[model samples]
Structures are given as structure tokens and as C-alpha cells.
Target: MRYTLFFFLLLLSACLQAQYKINLQINAPKDSIAYLRGVVFDDKNYFPKDTIRIKKNVVILQSKKPIVGGMYYVQLDKSKQRFYFILENNDNLSLEIRGGEIHSNNPRNQVYFQYQKLAKSFEVIDSLYDAEVGRGRKFSYSDKAAFFKVKTAALAAFRKKALPKLNPSEVLHIYFSALNRLDASVPDKKNYAARLAFLKGLDFNTNKLLFIPTYKELVSEYMGYYPTQADSLLKGVDQILSRVNCQSKSYPYVLNYFVQLMRNRNVQNNTEGFVKFVNTYVEKSSCNALSATVKKTLIDDAARLNKVVNLAKSPAISLPDTTGVTQDLHQFAASFDYTLLAFYAPTCDHCQKEVPEMDSTMKLIESRLNLSLGRFYVCNEPGVPQATWRKFISDYKITTNAKHVELPSVSDIRTQYDAFSNPVFFLLNRAGEIVARRISPNTLRKYFAEIQRQRMAQNP
Candidate 1:
């Protein structure tokens, strides 16, 4: 029993001290260097992690620490030639490279190489298939549809047969499974429940799957397919995070993913929902994956979001009118039924375009909606001389002729209104309450037109 315990202790110590080794046999000349790089998020994006120097056609890359598991490749410094492999949890690997092909001792690497070959083979075969169906013939619509059906079936069959034979293990297995589901998804259709289950059951503990290239594409497709409504999308985000182990590295990766996904304005518009997501998940997560600075930034941004986007009434500020006299913003807007709060810069080309477009939009809102509207344009640069502000207003035809103001400093505009970019806009109702935040000046005409159309539909 004592001997058994001693052996167990030795094993544990060995595992703790275990390092990574990659042995390569290449045709490069002696004294040549190679770069060891890796893929983490997107397939096309790679970053260097280490350097390996070759002597006499051989190189051994060694590390004092356990290398993080991911897909890695070795590229020659002076040559376009590269040797790629998918590596994870293995103590050591040996590869013989020739003519852009790798023969690896590690089974995982062998399987991944096979997978790559399969992908390339199918791509070549697809083009050939396209030619076979056409053969210099212009395909009719039915001919095209028939060719697509046959090609898709053949592709699915090839994958189904090839993946099972490759026999990927651990995280690689999960990636392939998710990839199959992704392949099954089409532009107008998907298996939502099955995909949701896959995500819910995914063990992020092995977090190496995060490095798989198309993993993000799968997640993106799932996010876009399931959520038809904005609220549903936000709730879906929370639901996914709720299943994650807060202390696991997956928690922070998934959290930041949703943050990035929501950042695309074309995807979602419920800034309040995203702010609450950040406040809830970011503040409470114990993952320790994010740096202290990043966590603080997220929390600060969430607070700023609530201040700018969640409030019933936007905070008031005083700024100088075009005449250089201080004017109250909310007070100036209170008498009007609705207000167009615009932030622009004197020199910004985009602001120049957006501000002028607002003229027609403002006119449409006032004439069609039959509402009392105020135009309050704020110059983002507070210290800009009144002459610059007046000239910009004149050039942009701010002939909305309501109120044009400027702040005292740029920092105040950035922090107070969260106007980091030029041409931020808001639509506000009377009583100083917000109707919409961060609207495009170009969309305002269509926006109010839709509102009037809805009103007529409901009343008629």
C-alpha cells in the first residue's frame, strides 16, 4: 500500500511537470528558422506563439510548460510552405512533412489531417460536379435544382461516412458533431431544438473546442436562427449562459461572444437588454478568465449603457447656442411634442452627410405626423469657435431652424451622452422621455412614416 501511494504521487508529479514537444523532419537547410503559430477564434486568423530553429533538416520545439491545446501549424520563415496539425492534450508529437502534406504520429493530428484532406477533396469534387452537370451547357432552373439535390446528398453521404471513420476523440468529437449540425442548416431553415441541446450539453470544461475555427460560425448561425424577436434573442443569450459553469473558462468566453455578437447593430437593437446581460453576467461571474481591467471596463460600459439607454428620461445638460449663449437642452425641448437630439462634429464627413439628410426627415415627421417637433443639434466639439459651428450649420442647412448648441469640452460629450462617434441621434417625446435612442438620421423618415402607417391601420 505504501509503495502504491508512492507510485501514485510520482505519477501526479510527472503529469504536473509534463511539457510539450514537437519533432519535425523537414527539407529546410540547416540554420533555418520556423514559426509555430495557432488558430483560436476564426480560421483565417493566426497568431505566432513560438519559434523553432532547424539544424540539419530536423527541429524539436520544446516548452517548459504545458501548451494550451488548439490547432497549430509550423511555417518556414523564408518559404510559403507550412505544416498544419490539430493538437490537444498530447505530451509529444512527431511529423514528417513533404510537399505541403503532413504525416503525424499523433492519432488526433492524423485524423485532423485526414479531415482537411476530405474538405479539400470535396471542394475539388464540387467544382468537377458543377462542370459534369453543365459541361459547357447553360443549365435551366430545373437542371440547376436537380444538380444541387444530387450534390448535397453526395456531400452529406461523404461526410457521414468519412467522419465516423476518422474517429475524432474528446473536444474534436464535439466539434465534428456541431459541424454536422451546422452543415444541416440552410439559409431559411435549421434544427433549432437539436442545436440548442448541443449547446446546452456542451462541456466547456475542455475549453479547447473554443479554438476550433468554424465553432464560431456554428454559434453565429444558431444565434441568428432561433431568435425572431429582440427579447427572445436576449433571453436566449441568458439561457445559454445560465447553463455554463460560472467558474469555468467557458463562462467568460461565451459571455464575451454574446457581447461581440450584440455589438453588431444590424443584429440587435435592444441596448437595454444587452446592458442588463453585461451587468448580470459580468458582475457575478467567477470565471477569472477575463483580466481585471477588462472586467472593470465591461462593468463600467454596462453602467454607462443603463445611464444612456435605460432611463425613462435622458439626463439634461446645458450647452452654448450658436450665438454663444448657454441654453438648457431638456428645457428647450419640453415645449415640443417630440425632439430630435443630434450629436455632430464640424469636420466629420459622416456628420456632414447625416446632418443634411435630417432636413428632409424632420420635415416628413412634422408634416405627415402632424406633430410639434424640435430639432436640437449639438456640436460634439465644445471648444470649436462659434464661427465653425455656424458655418457647419449653414453648410448642413440646419434650416430646421430650431436650436443648435455646443458643449464646453469633448470629454463631457463622450462621457455624459456616450457619444464616442459622430452623428449620434435620439428621438424623444414631451416630458423629456425617450422614444428611441441611437437612431439613424436617414431612417427617421421611414421610421415616422411607419409609425403614421401603423396609426392609420389601427384607427381605420
Candidate 2:
């Protein structure tokens, strides 16, 4: 019995020692809460993960539970003083702050410290250039050229000196290498290839690159680059995916980022691209990086998009009016040259603002084109109380002539229409074909005004 008790104590000791532990010394007063934060792609955002109070000298943070490997920051509670570190499960770390420099026994932190120094130095020079421009200081062509040359040389020197210090086998080395930024003013950047080429070469086998600002900057550059039309954007997303390993965290991040990016865009085939991206890259992928719930949710969203997406025939919808009588959408649309369908939730802030504008725009359309408000149809999404819908209608002062319809609870509204991001609009021609989608109130006014002017010129 004594031997068994001794063995249990030994096991407990081993279990306790196998935890992720860190001894950190920061420049703060006694009992201050030091927050352990996960660094997001934006270096400015340090999302707090855990916190512990600081002892007089060192704060030893430990958890028997595993912590995922990621770049993180240590911040004093409500203070600007912070430091960054790359951490992994069960990593033994010892660090101290002295004379504003971090002293660490961990070799990885040592390399990251070098990287941070070089990065900060580059940023200082970059910010000076930005401030010069922001101040509206004008530079001659030759002067600007000289500044570019100097800036490029400075970056090159920083990289060259820091290159030998990084071990090639280390994952931190790969992350550091991705931190190099090229001047957007360079002529090569006019081509999409130049913007994405740097990120394409990174070692995505390690997801450490995902947490760094450099990778995200290049990603934003590539995504936000000019000619951001549907095909170009889709191709840009594909290029990023081709370079990243499907098994890595980068796969889902890139897939979901671009999918959501293109979802709201009014460009032609943007919805198609959104669907194809999620289906082909993610649904077909064998990697477990993306959660099943997220994958299913995105897939279901893509399906909903297909229902009312631009250029598709408007699906058959029969909804009840505020008077407890049902109306057929196709039959109502037949009486008009065009039907404007608006789906909105009563509580949606954007819907509340837009619905009023829509009513005023309809009045303008009546005055300008001699069209009646009967052509406009405003729909309240299913599942909300009728009182909320009535309140929205009353608050917005919606026109009586227009059809104010409500999709009943336990209806096909979810399957037949997209009320996902409420206040979505679609312009349908008399043939029940979707002519334009997400048509705003202002846009509707402008379009009919253009048509009215063209018709007047034709008659004149």
C-alpha cells in the first residue's frame, strides 16, 4: 500500500512538470496583472488569452493543459508596455526585462528578438517616409528616386546582416524571412505577380507565418491589389491556396478569408466564385484544420447564395401580407415592368436605416418615371415577431401602396431566399429573372432616372 502511494506521488510530480511553464520578468509594480495574449495578424491587436498577477521579481506562468504554438504578447494590465514571444506546448521559457531589452534563455526567443529589432528599425524608416507624404511634402522625381534607393538599400542591409544569424532549419527563420516588405511604389508591383510572389515562397508547413504581420500585409496587398474584379480576385485566391499546404492552418484562413471577402461584392460571378472556392478547396479537402461546423455553415451559406444570386431566375415565393392574406410574387410581378424585392430583418441596424431611404426613393421614382409604388415589395424575414415588423414599418413610414409582406415562421424563406445579411435587394424584370442583386435605394433611384432620361430623349 505504501509503494502504491509512492508511485502515485511520482506520477503526479511527472504530470505537474510536463506542463507549459514560463518565468517572465517585466517592468511593472507589484501585483500588477500581466496578460498573456495571442497576437493577431494585425500587430496592434493583442487578444488576451490568460492573465496572472506578477510577483515581486518573476511571475511563473504554468498550465498542465497544452497551449497551441503561436506568436504571443505579454502585456501589463491597461498599459502600453508589452513584449512578444513565440511559444509552443511544454516549452521551457525563462525571460527577464532589463534596460528595456528582453533577456531570455530560449534560443527561439533570441532569434525572434533579432527579428523584432530588424523589423522595428525598418518600420521606423517606413513611418518617416509615410509622415513625409502625409505632411504633403512634395519631392522632385530625382529626389523621390534617391529616397527610394536609400530605403531599399537600408532594408537590404538589415536583411543581409540578420541573415547569417538565423538558422535555416529553424521555423522562426522561415517566419523571419517572410517579414521582408517590398516598396509598393516599385514598378514591378504593377503586376500581381510581384505582390504575391514573396508569400508564395514561404514555408507553410509551419503555421508560425500566419500570426506574423508580414504575411498578413502581403496577403492584404495581394487581395486588395488593383483589378480586384471577380476573375482576378478568384485567381489571386487560387494562387495563394496553391502555395499553402492544405494540412496547415493557412488553408482554412485563406479559404474563409476570400470566401467572406467576395460574398458581399456586387460584381458578376462573385457569388459563383465564393461557392466554388468553399466547395472545391475546402469541402473537397481531407485536412482537419477547418472545423466541421464551420465547413458545414459555409457550405450551407453558399447554397443559400445560389438561391437568389444574380442572373438566376427569381425563385417562387408566396408570402402573407400584413393583413393576413397570402400574395404570389410571380403574379404580382406580372402586373409591373419590374419588381424590386427587398429582404430585411426588423432589428438589423442597416435595415432600419435603409428602409426609410427606400420609401423616399420610391416617392422619387413615382415623381420622375410616373411609376407607382405597387412595383416595390418589402419583405420581413421569417422568425421575428409581427410586432417588431409592424414597428419597423411604422418607424420607417413605409408606403401603403407597396406590398409589405412577412414570411411566416416555419416557412421556406430560409430555403428559398437569402435573409442572412438582411437588407439585401434584388431587381427582377417582368419575366421573373434577376436583373440586378443587392440594388440599394440610391442605386434604384439613379437607374430609373437614367432610364427615364433615355426614354424622354427617344420620344423627343
Candidate 3:
């Protein structure tokens, strides 16, 4: 009876052990072994001496030949703090963190350090992910906090002495990984400052060994995050741009940097700065050899910049109505004593909200003088379906006076008028001279009043 009880206890112990085993469901491609990297439980460990009981759900095992690519099962017990990865390869390329010792010692310390740092960072990421799973659409403040916490710890780890001995590519990867993690958190000016400092420390000038692709991505992300610090960012960009002297190889980066600079100037309303910057480029000898498309882009940018600077100084712009027929601005202006030409898009919500109010102002002025208001729904691009355009027009509930037509090109029109955003209104007198321009719904009333006063002064 004692012997029977001992056997029963042994069976019970086996059942308990089975209960602790985490089942992993792995789906791998044909002929490829799964390369497991993340956490796994004790029962799933693929170490040669470890006995792994494959769960029923785990199927479709593939060959481990060539071993570089595939999917693998990883069962991880978060509660028990046990983890393992089961590889299909019986040839012993598999690895596990058994008391901090890796498979080998030649550069194995570096590998182990990287793995441990990554594992810790991933644990934090996993926690954040769990916190975010159920909260839909709404901002997950707690998850954001967790993310920042993990990122801060990861950054601390990266700043340690061990990172310097690593390869240039590895060092860059670490810097950018931290940069990306911080970017997803709340925008902190301090974080941007720290990132810039970290980047400067890397001495990108000497470390051409790091992959160019990775370096460019880091630069782009830095540009995006620190837009307000344009001057500082520009200094970094200038250094990088100087190194990228091959125009054919570096034009894209240069073009994008210039574009970002222009946008930042626009945001700050530093129109004079924008004009000066572009003018310098426009006047450069290299500008002559630039592609037509690039030259045109520069011209468009310059014109827009010029217009913004001249907003309070310049008169209105009058463009022809491009309805069923084409007409020049001069011809169109001669027909009416006062012409209000408006460029708008049907899909634009701002245009939809503002156009009706503008139409009311036009009606008020129509009976007072030989004044007319005309709208041209400029096709944003060529090949926009007629049906789609018509539907957009109908959906907006715009009237017959507001005709639909396609502009030759946005860049051309914008350059000619110095217009930027839509539902733009321009006023012209009988002599085809521009009188005034209005950009907002609230400004329409003021524009009409000023135009009327001007007309009365001229006529009287």
C-alpha cells in the first residue's frame, strides 16, 4: 500500500509540473525554423539537456537548415518569472540566459550585455503594451507614463561605459532606439535637448562606419521632434549636409532639410527670413543647373514666401474664371466694376464653412454696384473624376454662381497670386487693378466695406 501511495504521489507531481508548463502556439512558414528571440517559459527551453514536452497546439514544425530565418514558439510565465525558447534545430545553435553566461566568450560579453539591456527594455515595453490594450481611441496616460519610465531607464543603460566599445552601427541603433522611445512620450523640451547632446557626442563626422540609412532616419526624427528649435537643428543639418557633398546622392536630404526650414519659418511668421534663405539659393550658380521640377518648386516656395511677407503691403490678386470657358484676368475684370475672384475646394471644410458667409456678402454688394462674385473650384490635381468633382460640389451645396473648373496647376496659380490656403478671396476694380484680399470669413465684411469706400472715393 505504501508503494502504491508513492506511485500516486509521483503521478500527482507530474500533473502539477504539467500545469506549470506554458503552452506556446507557433505558426511558421514551410521549410523554415522559427528563430525565437523573446521570452519563453521553463518547460519550452530548447537547451540540449532540457526535456521539452511539445504542447498539442504547437504544430507545423519546419526544417532548421540554413537557420537564419523562421518563426518559433516561446512560452513565457510572467507570474513565475520563468522563460525559454524552443527551437526546431537539434544542432544546438539555440541559446538561453542561464545565470548570465552565454554560449561562448569571444565577444560573448558584448552580446550578453546587449541581450540583457534589450530584454529589460522590452519588459517595460510589454508592460506598457498591456496597459494600453483595453483603452481604445482615448489617450492612455498611464501607458505613456510607463513608456517614459522604461525609456528613461533604457537611456540610462545606453549612456553607461559598455556602449562605447560597441560597433558604430550598434551604438547608433541604441541612440535611435532611445530617441524613438522618447518621441512617443509627451513632448518635453528637455528630452529634445538631451537627444541633441547625445547625437553630438556620437561624432557622426568621424563615424561614417555607421550605416547611412540609420543615420538619415535619426536625423529625420530629430528634425521632426525639434521643429521649434530650427536654428539648432539647422546647425546639425549644415554639418551633415556638408559631409554629403555629392549632390546626386544627397539632393533628397538637402531638399527635405530646406523644406523643413521653410515650414518652421512659416510657423514663426518669419517671412523675411524665408525670403532671404530661398533668394540666396535661387541666385546661386548651382540653381541654373538644377532640374526644372526642382527650380519650379524653389520658385513656388519663393513666391509664397514673398507673398506672406508682403501681406500688409500688396494689393489684391485677380485671376481669370476657368469655368466652361477660359478667360484672362484683364478680360474678366473689364466686365464688372468690381470683381471678387475666389479660389476654393469643395472637400475643404474651411471652404464649406466660409463660402456661404462670403456669398451673403457678395449678395449685399451685388445690388450696390456693377460688382460680381465668381468662384472656381480648382481641381486639386489632374484626372480627378468628373463624377467625384460633381459629387463634391453638390455635397457642399454651393450655388450656380460658384462654377467648378480645373486650374492648370496649383503651383502655377499659387505663384501667380501669392495664395497659400484655400477659400482665398481677391478684389479687383473696373480697371483690372487689384484692390484688396481677404483670407478669413470674418475679414470678408471688412474687405467689402474698404472696397466700397475705395470705389466711392474713385467714382466721386
Candidate 4:
């Protein structure tokens, strides 16, 4: 009898330490497919790990082993919409979806649902506030302002009280969500200085919160307000970086996010800010985890960017013109006040439409502005039939006024200009410096015309 009791106790402990089990049920039309996707940190896209088929409006998904603590989502294959949920090691949870909403027995999920609801309601109120300003009314929130004040205070109090009881994942979510509430509130009428100070005060140097995607968004939105003020913008970024310990995960996360943000926004006009950031944090960072490849890539990108931005002369291009005569871009047409270099491919659909419009616009503008135009057709010589290139020129009637060039080496051209897309243009002044780049031909024309007008006004 004693041996049997001991055996039973051992079996109970084994069961208690078993792998996580998840039971998910969906009440939908018959024969629906649900994809269970694994979550990636700071990425909105999900990759399916498993798929379950619904029969009689019921489908269950489970894990044979413990999953790493993070977020996961259930997506309907038919609708392609996803709903999020939290997962932790050895979590035995059940979720039910009905009437386009999810119900879960887990406390973490309950808190997430509550936050979502509150955020949705706050968005509605914020939209009304924006609508009033859209109609040209003074930016007065009136009753909404009072409501936001009370709501924000209550959220802060609730978060402070409830955060300790929640897990790290849930705490980060609720903390960021609560902080987001302050963004919608109306600022003081006489001064908005307090808002900037509040934004600067938020700490993002923790490693655990680094996994949350919203943290990057918060940093971006806060720093984006001072685009022209490079000093102010870098100051704001420096505040966040100051808290980041170089030895921690937050170092790479913050640095990489900063680089990607500048790249995406094309901060050429504010290159000083980019330069300052790289110098202060990137160069000075001696973190052991900072890999050599990443450092080299970052330095290389900054070098490439600096060369082509404003004062840097355009890279030299030596390719055969449409007539099979080789000519360098520097000597092709050196007399004009500005040269428009257009890079394109024959097979690109957007290029097909955009190239013609650009050709026509440049011709029209050249009749008035002192501008030169060159079209570089990027294609392999023998591989891409010469007939295709000739036909493109004939269709666009480009040869009547503009100089045409055919480039066989596509890789070198892409690297020199950092041309990621087709139909890229660069405007060079008479001195051969790149005065304007990555802008529409029409915008460049307007800018040139305005500059000429300003000059004439000064002379008159």
C-alpha cells in the first residue's frame, strides 16, 4: 500500500510538469481554416507554424512542447485577418472566438483585451477632436479634453496598481499602451513645452521592453516632430541613447532602429543629424556584441550617403548612347545650368508609364529653364535585345531632344546611385554637384523656376 501511494505521487508530478497545451475553438461558418502563426519580435508579419481545419464549428490547436514567451496570432485563411494572443512556457490556456471577438480564460489575455478596447475608444474620441480642427475651428477639445484628462489619470493609476501582478510581457504592453494615452490629450493653449519634456522623459533603455514593437514607434513619432531642427532632433534621440547601456541588447536594438529610421525617411536634408548620431553612439560604442559586419555596413552606408547628398558631385557614368557611341555624363552636356539624369529599365511597368511622362515634362520645362536631360537605359547589352531599347526610344520619342544612353552593367549603376527602384532621377547644377535628388521631375522644375524667379527679383 505504501509503494502504491509513492508511485501515484510521482505520476502526479510528471503530469503537472507536462508541455504546454492550448485549446482554441472558433464559432464560424462550417469548414473554415485557421492558421496558427509564430510571432517575431518588432515585426508585424507572421509565419504560419501550424494549420487547423474546423469541423462542426470546432478546431483545437496544441503545442507538444513549451514555446518561448512572446506573442502569437490566429489568422483566418479565408479572410486573411489576424487576432493576437500571448503565449508563455508551459501555459495551459483556452481561447474562444465568436462574433468577431476573442474570449480567453488567461489573465494576460484578459488584460490585453481590456487595453485594446480602451485604445479603440480613445481613438474614436481623438478622431472627433481632429475633425473639429479640420473644419478650421480653433483647436478646442472642450468636453473631450476634460474626458481625456480623467481617462489618462485613471489609466496611470490602474497600471501602477496592476503592473506588479502581471508578467513581464503583459506589463510592457500595458505600460506602453497607457503612455500612448497622453499623446491624444490636448496640450496647454499658451505653451506646448511640457509635451516635449514629457516625451524626453520616457525611458526605453530596458532590455525586456526591447521586444515590444510599439517602443520603436513611440521613439520615431517623438523624434520625427523636429525634422528641420537637427540639434533638437539629435538631442531627443540622445536622451534615449543615454539610458542605453552599450553592453545590453538595447544597444543594438536602438542603434539599428535609428539607422533604419533615417534610411526610410531619406534624411539627406538633415544629414547633420545622421552624422551626429553615428559619431556619438555608433562610433563610440565599444560593446562586445556589436558585430564587425554590422559596424562596417553602417559606416559604409553613411559614407555612401554623404558622397551623393548635396555638395557631392554626381558619380561618373560612361555608357553607350542610343547611337552606339560611348559618352561620359560629365562631358555629354556641360553647358547647361542643371542636368537631369534619369535611370530606367525597359521591362519595368512603372518605368514604362513614368519615363514617358518625365520625358515630356522635362522637354516642356527645358523650353523655359536652362536644363539638360540624359536618360540612362539600364539593361544587359546582348541579353536585352537592342530592338527593345530602340523601340522604347521610338515610343517615347525621347531622342528628339534628350540624350540617351544604354548601360550594360546594371549592378554597378545601382550601387553608385543607390537606386533601389526604377525611374530614379538626379538634378545636377552647372558645377556638377548634386543639388537635388530622388525627387519628381516636375518638382525639380518648379524648384528651378522658383530659384530663377527669385534671382530675377533680386536683380530687378
What is the lDDT of every predicted structure here? 0.68, 0.66, 0.47, 0.63
- The candidate that wins on lDDT is 1
Could you give candidate 2's per-residue lDDT for residues 325-380 as a string of tens digits? 88877777777777778877888888887767777777777777776544445455
Please report, as a residue range, the 10-residue window in candidate 3 with the lowest summed lDDT. Answer: 38-47
Candidate 2 lDDT score relative to the true structure: 0.66
Error of 4 at 346 (Å): 3.5
By lDDT, the candidates rank as 1, 2, 4, 3
- List TM-score per model, in order: 0.66, 0.63, 0.40, 0.64
Candidate 1, residues 87-191, lDDT tens digits: the string is 665457778776668898877677767766756655765686677766646654345445556545655565576576554555456566666665555423255
Better of 2 and 4 by TM-score: 4
* Model 4 lDDT on a 0 to 1 scale: 0.63
**Residue 234 lDDT, candidate 3, scale 0-100:** 51
The order of the candidates by TM-score, greatest first, is 1, 4, 2, 3
Alpha carbon deviation, residue 341, candidate 4 (Å)? 1.9
lDDT of 4 by residue, 344-424 (tens): 777778678767877777777767755555543444333567788778778877664467777655457667776656767
What tens-digit string does per-residue lDDT give for candidate 3 at 88-144? 222223233233232322252335346555766567566756676655333444445
Best by TM-score: 1
**Candidate 2: segments with Cα more than 4 A from true spot:** 1-21, 26-32, 40-50, 62-70, 76-83, 86-179, 182-200, 226-230, 265-268, 286-312, 318-328, 331-339, 353-402, 437-460
By how many angstroms RMSD does model 3 differ from the true structure? 15.2
Candidate 4 global TM-score: 0.64
